[model samples]
Target: METTAPIVDRWGGGTCPFDAGWKKVMMWSFIITDGLLFAGFLGGYGYARTMATVWPDQSTVFTLPFIAAMTFVLISSSATMASAVWSAQHGQRAVAVRYVWLTLVGAVLFLGMQAYEWTHLIEAGATLSGNPWGDALFGAYFFVTTGFHGSHVLIGAIVLLVLGINLARGRSTTENVEMAGLYWHFVDLVWVFIFTCFYLL
Candidate 1:
């Protein structure tokens, strides 16, 4: 009797071909979904602003200098994240670690500025239930958009901390750094949209 060769199952195999690049693909998928959500929020905010009898003047409602500084901090963090990725790609572990630390510092400063802004706004009588600008939409847009961005910044900080620890322990390789870079870049890219839509225009 001749024995037949055993056939391997693609799905049950130790390494499935589809699973090899699934993580990166999933990240991109998630980013697209999140982009859509943000776009929806922004569209609603725009519509409400246009319809309001007394749309809030951003210049009067927001402290330009403070927000400008915060924006600078966030942009600086993105720069550091880019540096970190570059260093990792070139196999400079120490340089990558240092840049990551700088990035975390910038993240912390940005969060602090945001906290200060929120408190200042609340003290000035701007709340989800009330609007200082006479149009309720102002408060609603402020809370929803900034709150969402704040949450992203918080998550980015946590991820940065984890990546920093791993790098210090020699556990994170170049590929791991690159993976973290994807997340860092995404956060930065989202901020660009937020700044443009909410602050600039």
Candidate 2:
């Protein structure tokens, strides 16, 4: 086997070290790994759908205009998060705080919309065991993936609230705002794939 020496930059920085910060490198790694986990889930869903003799028609299952609104709301939140990070970077603390607040509003609306969807489905006989629509397994995949994503949204909201408080107290840093924005952006991007694959298809 061939071997190569580790590369180091000026000031003796190694390949894994970040010029930005260690937190950013670590955060990127965590987000990438989480992305793979979600991919595994969606891949399983795709395989199951393909191999099954019968799969639920997504249109009849999730046919609602409000779901599109939910997608739009989350996308808008991502933009707000970007603005928050930008403002924080520019030393505009109040603007950053206000944008983060807007992001939180968007997050709350996303969760509320999901709750509304769940209520409608559950009342129509959708359950973990089975749903009235089609394959029983469809409910499993749908709820598991969607619930996982929703949990991330809820956690993001809590993080935003904490960041908001810190910002108000003049304790939050630009790096802190950027880290939160990364996670929010990842959530929004992942939802696009989920929505396109599960709903639009």
- The TM-score leader among the candidates is 2
Q: What is the lDDT of residue 13 in candidate 1?
A: 62
**lDDT for every model?**
0.84, 0.89
User: Who wins the lDDT comparison?
Assistant: 2
Which stretches of candidate 2 lie above 4 Å from their native place?
A: 1-17
On residues 1-201, what C-alpha lDDT tens digit does candidate 1 reach at each position? 133222344444676546546667677788889888888988898898788788777788888888889888988889999999999889888999999999999989999999999999999999987766678777888788889988988998998999999998889877677777777778778878878777777
Cα RMSD of all models vs. native, in order, equals 5.9, 2.7
In the predicted model 2, the residue pairs found to clash are none
Worst lDDT 10-window in candidate 2: 1-10
- Using alpha carbons, what is the TM-score of model 2? 0.92
TM-scores of all predicted structures: 0.86, 0.92
Error of 1 at 25 (Å): 2.1
Residue 33 Cα positional deviation in candidate 1, in Å, after optimal superposition: 1.0
Model 2 agreement with the true structure over 22-100: per-residue lDDT tens digits: 8888899999999999999899889888887878787787865878999999999999999999999999999999999
